[model samples]
Structure formats: structure tokens, C-alpha cells
Target: MNTNLSNDNEFENDAESRIETEVSSEVESTPEESGAEENLIEENISTSETAVSPTSAEITTPIEDNEAAGEVKEVKTASAATSNNQGMSAMAKGLAVIAVILAIGAGLVFWKMKVGTHGESLNRVTAEDMQIILKDANPMQLKALAESPEQKKKISENIAQLLAVASQARKDGLADEPIVKQELENIRAVVTASIYDQEINKDKGPMPQFGYISEDQVKEFWNDTSHEAEFQKFIDSKLTLARESGKFPKDKELTEEELKQAKDDFAKIMIYAEEAKEKGRDLGEDFNREVELQVKLQQAQFLAGRYAQKVLADKVKVTDEDVAKYIAEHPEYDTKEKKAKAEQILSRAKAGEDFAKLANEFSQDPGNKSPSGELQGGIYKDVPKGQMMPAFEQAALALESGQIADNLVETPYGYHIIKLEKKGEGKDANGQPTQTYDVRHILITTTVKDPTNPMGREIPVTESVKAKLAEEKQKQVLDEIVANNPVEVAEDFTVPQPSQEDLQQMQQQMQQQMPSRMQPPPAGDIEPPNSQEPKKPQPRQ
Candidate 1:
């Protein structure tokens, strides 16, 4: 019983020991497990820290039920960034479009303004404005006005003023004055007559076959006539006057000195004459033909003048008052005393008397001879102021009314003693006339030398060589004329005898003057069928 009891106690103690050992083992296992858990917790904390360091700590936290909200926030941020970028791009594009549109619009506006403004300014100008602009404008200014829009406005304003003045003058009835009417008529007549003469000359074909007036005929007439002798007589009388006036050399009795001077003068005259002849000769057949045409023209002019006088006689009316008015206006016209008397004076002056003394002695002027020198008469009413050379006009103007000027009035023609028998009112304070002379002069001119040919080719005869040859030829022509001279009685000269061909031409011309209906067709041509009752034969000459 005691052993059994002791074994139970040992078993109890072993069991307690085993339980304790097991508990200890369990505690150790718990420690190991706890250690393992600590290690794991430490590792997890380190990993979490590392992750938090690399990423956000908030990301490591578990998202709540508001994860969708976070996602929405993120989405909103992305959207905002995208919208901002898109907005910038859209703004950039909008600005570019606006800039292009504004630029194009500005260009269009500028172009329209420029075109419209220039067009309006141009339309405002008138023809008269244009004329004035053209008239007074300098070339550079005109170019600017033409090209630049700004300048054209100023040019148009200047021209309007001139037209106004011209219009006023016409409205004053100045255009209908008798003098104005006469002047207009004269201008019209001149223009019309020129046209008529041109037409008539055109109608007349080139001159007849004789190469202008038969040179043979001209030479014959010149030689047969006593005109040259008469002309020489007149020249001798002029020379005598010159001698008496002491214009010639003083050794009057044909002394050796006088003879020598005379010979020298004659030689000079002969030289001039020879030169004139040469010039006339060098004017070839064309010139001769022109001369014939001139003769015909002169004849035509005379006939036309007569016809014009008859046709226009009613238009020209003269009154005594008109004549008096004319004389009053033209003081140089014949004075009452001059018209009343025909007394002439020839003062006997000493040979070689001073020109002033001669003038004083012979002057018929009513004014004192102290300031007056040479005096004469026969000045026409239509004499011009400066037409007489400066010297003559100065002398004439210097004298008082009816006063003779000092010294002989030398001119291209000869010396003259100016007489102031009449006093007249002058247009100016100085006795100058207001009227401008419109005189028509017909010049019968002779040149000493022939002009150089247009082609620069040498003439058949040089100027120096022509004179002698021309004189010889003229003499030969004269001789031929004398041989062939023919005389016509007054009856025979009454009418010109036309040649057969000329008569035929005249008949044709008369026929042409008739209506076209009067003309007959050519003999070879057949008449149109049923055109006329009978075919007419060609008209006989």
C-alpha cells in the first residue's frame, strides 16, 4: 500500500513536471512565435516606411468608400489642365484669325478710301478749269497735279476765276461794236477768200507746156519796152536831188576825184546788179514756173477783189463824221491846212549845207525850227510808232506839235526832212498811236546770193561765179526776146485765144459742171436693159 502510494506520488510529480515543462515549452514557443511576429511587424513597418518614402503616405492608407471621389478629383484636375491647354491653343488660333481679318480689313479700307477720294476730286474739275490749269501751270506743278490726288484739288480752283472775267467782257455788248463787227467780218473774209483761192488754184491743173511764161516772151517784152530807160531817168533825177542836197561827193564838175568816186559807185552798183541777175538765173525751171503761177494769182486776186467789193459794198458805210473821227483818232492824218492848201516849198540851200540848216530852211512845220530840224509831209494815217527806225521815232516824238526835229532823218531808203504841218492828239502822253497797224506787204525781193541747197550738194554755179554768167545769159535772153517780139492791137488783146486742146478741156469742164444725169455713158458700154427709152450717143466736142 505504501509503495503504491509512493508510485502515485511520483507519477503525480512527473505529471506536474511534464505539465510545467510543457508550459515552459509552450512559453518558449510563444516567445519564438512572438519574436517571429515582431520581426514581421518590424519588416512590415520598414516596408511601409520605404513605400511611404517613395510614394505618398496617404496612398498606403486604405481608400475609403470615397475612392470614387478621389478618382473624380484626379479626373477633374486632368480635365482642367487639358482645358487650359486647349483654351490657350484656341486663344492663339482666334488671335491669328482676328489679326489676319483686321489686316485685310485695314487694307481694304485704305484702298477704298484712296480710290473714292481720288475719283471724287477728279470729277469736280471742269474743262475751263483744265484749260486754266494747263495755261498758267509750270511743267513740274502740272505733272504733280496730274499724278497726285492732293494737288489736283488746288489746280481746279485757279481756273474758275479767269472764265468769269472773259464772260463779263462779252456780256457788255463790246462784241457787237462796229469796229468789232468789221474786224470779225474782215477775219472771216480773209479765211473764206483763202479757202476759195486754194480751191480755185487746186482746180487749175499744172501750168501749160511752155515751162512757165515763155522766158523768151518775157525777155522780148522787157527789151522792147522803154521802161528801163524811164527807170534810169528816175534814178538820174534822184541822183540830181542827192547832189543838190550835198549827199553826193562835193567835187561836182566831174573832176578826177569825182569821176573816180562815181566809177567806184558805178562798179559797186554793177556788182549788185550782176548778183541779182545771178540769183534770178539760179532759180531753175521750177522758179520760172512759180513766177507764171504768181502772175495768174495776181490776176485772180484783182478779179476777186472787184467781186468782193461789189458783194460787200452794202456792209461798208462811211460818213463825214466817221472820217473826222478817224482823223481825230489818228492825229497823223492830213491836217486842215494841209487839206486846204497845196503850197510846196523848195529852199535854196548852199552846196554842202548842214542837214539841220537845210531842214530848218525847208521845213513847213508851224512849230519853231529851233527844236525842229528836217520836216516833210505825206505821212499816212496808218503809220506805226516804231515801224520807222528807233532814230526816226525818237526824233519825231521829241518835237512839239507841228515842230520839226533836228537833223536829216536818215532811213534805209534815204534822208528825209520831216514836216509837221498838223497837230494831232496822241494816244499816249508821248505822241504815240494806240492802234496797232495791220498792214499787208507784198515784197518783190531780190537776193544777192542763192541759198545753199537742202541736200548740201554744190550748185551748178557758185555765188562768186554766177554773176558774170547770169548777166551774159540775161543779155542773150534779151536779144532773143527782141528778135521774137510781137505786138498785139487793143482789139486782139481784148480776149485770150485758147488752144484747141484747151477749148476741149474747157468744154469737158463745163460738161462736168452740169448734173450727173446730163452725162452720157462710154460708147463701148451697153445701156442697162429697160433703163432708158433710147441710148444716147457720146457728146461731140
Candidate 2:
């Protein structure tokens, strides 16, 4: 019986030892054996976000299973709360930034509406005030004009009238006209564009005194298809303004090649303007001022022109009878008497008369005289074809040596009694033979001087003269309007005159720049870098 009890105890001890060994093996398994099981546990934990807690059945160690599971859950909850707080903080920062931007915008609007009143008032347009509107206006030019009190007053009066007319036009709803609106827009765009180009090139070393657009930029702009519509609008506006000024033919149209050349010539200005807008360069102070000046100038001019055409046409119309009356008052403007005088001289020259004697006695052409204003026998040496007027050049070219033109040749300046002294040939700078002629002629002066000029000296009757004549009548009308409106010029807003030393320095600088100005510009296949072809329209006076 004792031996049987011993056998049973040994068997119990062996089974208990084997169970202990199996549990140890499961808990401390090799990485290679548990790799697949680890992957499944990781995926389950990520998807379900289930906190891993050891079940009572799995926990064989001395540690308390429920307490350990509770600790793990608390750690995860704290970490998640930290992440949520961070997200909320970031969202709050974004909202705060947006609110600040809105506040800044509101402040700007408020300042422009309230505080900007004095700056923009037209009732008192001062030189300092004009500086805001005409920022790019040459300081030297203003100083020069201000040197004369008369000039300063004239400027003030002109500006006042312009503002008054523009104001009236707005009230009349003329600003709403599509054509007028487009013209104002064109002026603003062009002036802004010009300012932008100048600013960018301000640091590029010495430039032309008047400034010039770059050729490479112009070429690039011509090829660009973008902004084509804007280009067309500008061209149209320029033409319309020109036509309104009565400076160009009513039926004028740009030729195909001319249009392309125009594009290249004006490309830098228009394209840079577009770029300035896109790049927000238009917000610059200089650009803004020039734009405002040009826009206001164009608007005023447009309104004034329309008013002159519609309202003052009959009141200011110069009749043939008026011209005759003017000629009677100023005998020097009598072209009919001058033409007869030219015919008489031409007959004598053709009637075996000594041409030089006739030219000395009868020629009134200032160019036909010496620097001392003495008649130089009206002899032009080696005259080129294009140097003379069409009728004068034609008559001279048709004549043989020592032969006089059969009839008096008429031109804007006067009637010419041309005597061909000799035909000649000359070599140009390129060493190419060029046709030239030497001629003796008596000129009968027919051009009328500006009635307003006290000197009444013989001067070219340019567009400026015509404008002055027109302005005389317009001024009468504007004076009445201004009397009613009553604008004021600021007393303290004075322009400083340069000292004599300053003037000398300016003259010396101009002299120094003469050589560079005379030098031929860099060559370009598209357009001359400085070409102002398809000439920009002049603003109305």
C-alpha cells in the first residue's frame, strides 16, 4: 500500500511541471513565430481604437490585471484630449487673422471717406495740391513757368476752368457716354503705363532726357496676344481724340503695316501698364497721381471740345467776312496782296531780270536771309528734294539751270518765285550720290502771326497757333462759367524758381547730353526704339 501511494505522487508532480513549462513557452515566444499574430493585433487596435486590457484568464502573473488595464485607458484619454486642444487652438488663430484683415480694410475705407476730403477738394487747387494730381509733372517745367507771375496765373486759370467744365459735364451725364468714358480710361491707362515704365528703369543708368521705351520690351509686347483688345481700344481712343481735335483726316485708318508698327512702337507702354496692374504696381503713389492728372485732363478736354462744337459753334464761328475784317485791321495778314506781289516778282525774273536783285528786294522768307536778318539774295545752296514744300520743290526741280518757274508756286508759307541757279549731286554720309539743287527764290510771306502776340513777328503757323485762336473764343465762354463757379488758387502754394547758378548747371548738363542725343540709336528690326509713330494724340488745350 505504501509503494502505490509513492507512484501516484510522482505522476502528479510530473503533470504539474509539464503545465508550468507550457505556459512559459507561450509567454516568451520568438519574434519569427509571433510575427503574423502581432500584425493582426496591430491592425485591430488601429481600426477599432480598442484599449488593450489583459483578461483575468490571460493574467497569470502576480500583478492586478484590472488595475493595469485602468491605467492604460487613462493615458490614451489624456493624449487624445491634448490633440483636440491643439486643433482648436490652430482654428482660433486662423479666425483671428481673418478678423484682423477685415478690420484693416474697414479702417482704410473710413479714412478715404472722411479724412481725404481736404486732399481731394477742387475748390482750392494749389501747387501742392496739384503735386498730388500731377506727380510726374517735371519740377523743372513748373519752376520755369512759375518764374513768371503771368504764367502762374494762366496755369491756375486754365486748371480752374478745366475742373469747372469737367464738373458741369458730370452733372450733364456726359461722363456716362461710352465714347467719353473710354477716352478717359485710355488716358489713365497710358499715363499710368508711362509712369510704371519710368519707375522700373529709374536705376538703369543714364536715359534720354525725355525717357524712351526699350526695343526688346517693345518686340516682346508686339508678339504677345494677351491684351490685344485693350490695345485696340487705346488705338481707337487716340484716333477719336485726334479726329475731335480736327488734326487728322476724318476718314483716316491705320494701314495694316502701320498698325503692326504702332503696336511695336507703343508696346512697352501698354504692356507694362497691363503688367503693372497684374503685379499691383498701379497702387504706387507716383502711378496714382499721374493717372489722376491724365484722366482729369482728358475728361475736361473732351467736355470742353463737345461744348465748343455744340454750344459755342455759331457764337465763335469765324466767317470769311471776319477774316477779311481781320486782314483789314492787320494788313500783314493780307495773303491776296502778297500773292499778287509774288506774281509780279515771278514775271520780272522770267523777263530776263537779274534773279539775285529780285530776291534781295522782294524775298520775305526769314530762312532766305543771313543771321543779321539781311537778305542773302534768297540763294539756297544744295537744297534737297524733301527740304522744300511740295509745290516749291516741284517747280524748282522742273527748271533747268538759270531758268525761272513759269508761275508763282504756292505753299503754306507764301508764294515762291523760284529760279534754278544750278543742278548738283552730293554724296550722303553713306557715300551714296544724292540729288541736290541750288536755287534763288523770292518768297512772299503769307503766314499770319498770332493776333495775341505783341511782337507780331513772322513765325510758323503751327497747330499751336490754331489752338490759340480757338482758345481765345473758348476762353470767353469759360470765363463766364468760372465767374459763376468761383474756384480759388492757394496763396502759399508757390513754385520755387531756380537760381542763375541752377540754370547754368541745367544748360551745361543739356550741352553735355547733346552728343549722346545726336548719336544714332541702337538698331532694331521691328521699330525704332524711340519712335513715336502713329503719333500719340495731343490733349486738347
Best by lDDT: 2
Candidate 1: tens digits of C-alpha lDDT, residues 430-532: 5666532211111111111223223221111112122222223323432332234321111111111234554454455546657774667665424333221
lDDT of 2 by residue, 377-478 (tens): 777676544445556677889989988888887654567788888887875335568887787778776655434333423333321133333345545655
TM-score of 1: 0.16
RMSD of each: 65.7, 39.4
Q: What lDDT does model 1 reach? A: 0.26
User: Which runs in model 2 stand beyond 4 Å of their true positions?
Assistant: 1-153, 182-322, 329-353, 358-439, 444-457, 460-471, 480-541
User: Which segments of model 1 are wrong by more than 4 Å?
Assistant: 1-384, 387-391, 421-503, 506-541
Which residue pairs of candidate 2 clash? none
